[model samples]
Target: MTMYSVDVYSGSSDSIIQDSHAQAVIVKATQGTGYVNPKCNHQVELAKSLGKKLGYYHYAGGGDPVAEADYFIDNINGYIGTGMLIIDWEGYQNSAFGNTTWVRRFVDRVHDRTGVWCVIYVSESALAQVANCANDCGVWVAKYASMTWGSWTVPNMAVSSGAFKFITGWQYTGGDMDRSIWYLDEAAWDKFAKANVANPTPSPQPKVDQAKPVVNPQTTWTDNLGDTWHAEDGKFISNTALHLRWGARPSASTIAVLPAGSVIKYDAWSRGNEFVYVRQPRGNGYGYVAVRNAHTGEAYGRFE
Candidate 1:
């Protein structure tokens, strides 16, 4: 029997449950923003409970492509039985930031490190930008024309440098409502996984301070390890007891329990309230954190 897969922006627990017919699910995680929409770890746990093959998609954000790829690895390094790490490249332009040559190199780096197949997700227009390097990556073309959510097809877009023919999947609709079939089954996924190796001893990451793109002083960011600091001022701090609550009221929602040294980004202060809105930027999206416990004075310099 042909296996099927569903791709959804992370955080749509209900949608994934509704589309339980699919054998696998791809959760979208964008750079600079952090793991797509579903920001909670429990959401991931819920998806796995459905007994579906699980994977993640990184929404290709422009700018330092390598940095973006690293963000993805940081968040999803330990996820087990992950399928191909789909790189959704729809918004890419032909400009400097959208350079296909650089994009391909970044994709290679991610695949080399993750031990998973790297698939490209793009529309016709976006595909043109990466026409030259398309052959280096698998293709997941998105072509939608129907009025309803799940009815669409994968057009015969050009892949790599040749007449594009091999397409693994098609995204026929938008949002969590779309539906499609998988071109590869579990055995295929296993083969692809075996072909690649995981955690290929990443090249020494550049020191964040000495690195360019100088951190914005206005924005304070944090890493996955609860290491809090101001990216711009080059100040690092440690807060042993920081907790993140969802929503405005104290009782609204309680999300993550952050330990000391976790990296985070400063979002905003609740209107006239004492709590600051901080987020964990895992390249997918942002996770909310409270400022009450984030004020600890311990600090560190550029993360290596």
Candidate 2:
């Protein structure tokens, strides 16, 4: 079924739900590295009160996409009305090196954190910015065929862009604000209402053991726990609470919980290729953490 929503920035101070007939709203939740949309929480809360589905997007400025994705998720992850996580990828230069890589990093990280795969919002210029971006993510495109409030044809134009399997949204109107139609039917839209990891309390992540002593994969390394380590990179924990385990797997015993910004020294990769062996970055015992903490681009993670 066709759904409508508007993407707003800090300038949108009006009551979005009260002012429009849209079924959902995609508020700009964050920008660049540290800034957040002041009105986003209000919009989300208001949308929730009105029983409207809600969504959010992050303005992916030319920075680390992984960090930006985490920032975006941090701002709006647990909303009961959340329908989608969109990465606004329209203005980060013309398919620059590491652009697709960073976007994918962001997408995968958001999925890992929220259990929902995020969608990408792009203009025609950035439609093909990242190859395989839509393989795992839905694509929301912005190709305005008309600017008037009645311009429903723009959604058709957006579909012609070939940016997605189906265009999630088509920005038909632009000016002081932007508006679009989510191209899903009511049944499909309902599925999207909580489609992206809607579990209010995510089920406990089972631990996957990775304690194998790998003699060689890319480079040879010893399995000794206290072996001398080499420098691949430096990183610190960025999540609010991170689990420390007795082994290099998700199922390892939770030895401790390290708070956000804990400094960690990544020791090596586990045999399973999913967990990371880290030194006592938080003075916690050395065990393992998932290798997908891209908020700060942790080493042995999705991002370099």
Candidate 3:
């Protein structure tokens, strides 16, 4: 269904109402040199409140790509792994640095740190500068306020059917403003959202008893990262108080807020070392939480 979505920036309206027809929104949440979009959180929460899938972008400013990527990632960490962390590349302020290499560095850093795939956003003139990288990452080419056949000089066709080959986003225009259409249909769009955005802000978790087992009738519970739950019940002493989530996914709902030094009975589901599944303290429910990395036999969870 070629879904409709928008890309906004600091100049865009602070208050936004969810557009049911729009499947998602890509907001400019950060920019070069540690500058952040003031309304990033509000825009994200508003879009999420309206049930719209959300993504974020950073306006590159010809700086240290790695450092800039780190800055952007830090700002969007809450929304990290939720959707695309776009590298908005037009050109560089620093004549000394090459745009393509820096863009790749930034994108790689983002992916390495967040585990969510990054995308590229470039103007028509700037597309060629990063086209080499675009084939690896989905490219959001921005020629203008709208995308129409032959509207821009750059060809909007397939470089290849690779990871981000298809111009997944073509910025078509409306009301003299910027908007984009996901090239794939509804199912693919949804699938893309889930695959790219593994985490978002969680909802409130339901109460559960600490000693009860965390399980469901079925045994096929896993996440995009391939971490399985309902494996085994294990006891963990909290190295620090953590926020409990409804599920193992980072975007799960927060069910319990535990303070440091609290001992928790949890299922020892293994997914690297940052995420842990614990039975709730009050009900027979399972909630996810992140803890400090366990040392030797100490309990730990992944944060980065």
Candidate 4:
């Protein structure tokens, strides 16, 4: 059976947990070394009094991982074996945000002190940053369907945890309060909280390499550069520097210059403005990148 959870911070009111029917309530306990959630102890006690499963998290301030971990452990030492330990790895005010090694050190220290591996919480786009932490810590991804407020009704959405074999928890929606789904039962949740040994680390993935970028193959076109380009829609990795533009035309303003080994997932490609351009559906509008000099038949990068 699926389990529901709600995560809260100092800004959250007690009524959120009091009214939530979620099976688990993860309370934010501390941030960096200076700030502690004043409502943390009260929230944990409230969750326990209601006989709900409990969790506590530390907000990473991008400080020294060992020092932050020590602060988190010192405050939540009593709840180490009982509540799920989490490290909130967001970019807000976090200097070491995308540095996976910082995350590794913090969680490793938590395990050293409490013998409990803390789960890493990050956005779906930042999954690759924490790929190294998959072995010892669980992944808690936050990807909302919409910011709209709603009941505990699960949205019709499916998400991948990138290189990680599977996600331990998915926070699917957030507005007034954040909601998540856990695939495991109470026994599994407790096992993760109380795990004393490190899990076997998996083989590391290449630094810039990830899962296959292409989805479907349609047709092919040979450019003047003698490079065969696939026509179907999918991801494209630039072997060299390329300029992304606002329009498919050369006269269009340059949006951003993507460096070598940059990856862009395009929705479609078209031959226009003396160039072959890939259309990237981003946000509300689309961004276009010239993949080849269409008139000269010169390919800009390898197309898969």
Report, for every candidate in turn, its global Cα lDDT versus the true structure.
Answer: 0.50, 0.57, 0.56, 0.74
Estimated TM-score for each candidate:
0.54, 0.57, 0.53, 0.65
Candidate 3 all-Cα RMSD: 22.2
For the record, the alpha-carbon RMSD of candidate 2 to the native fold, in angstroms, is 19.6
The pairs that clash in candidate 4 are: 224-297, 225-297
Candidate 1 lDDT at 173 equals 48
**Candidate 3 global lDDT:** 0.56
Task: Report the C-alpha lDDT of model 4 over 1-304, residue by residue, as the tens digit.
Answer: 4568988877677877886578899999999899999999999999898878989999888889999999999998888789789998876568886686899899889888888888888877688888888767788887654333245765555556776777778887555568888866787777777868444232232232235442232355554544333344567788789888887767879889999888888866654425667878878687888876532235666655
* Model 1 misplacement above 4 A: 10-13, 33-40, 92-98, 147-165, 195-304
- lDDT of prediction 4: 0.74
Residue runs of model 3 more than 4 Å from their true location after superposition: 14-21, 92-98, 145-164, 185-304
The digit string of per-residue lDDT tens for model 2 on 205-248 reads 22323564321212224555532232234454545567767776
Best by lDDT: 4
Position 297, candidate 4: lDDT: 36
Task: Quantify how close model 1 is to the true structure by its C-alpha RMSD in Å.
Answer: 17.8
- lDDT (C-alpha) at residue 120 in model 2: 76
Candidate structures ordered by TM-score, highest first = 4, 2, 1, 3
Stretches of candidate 2 exceeding 4 Å from the true structure: 92-98, 147-158, 161-163, 193-304
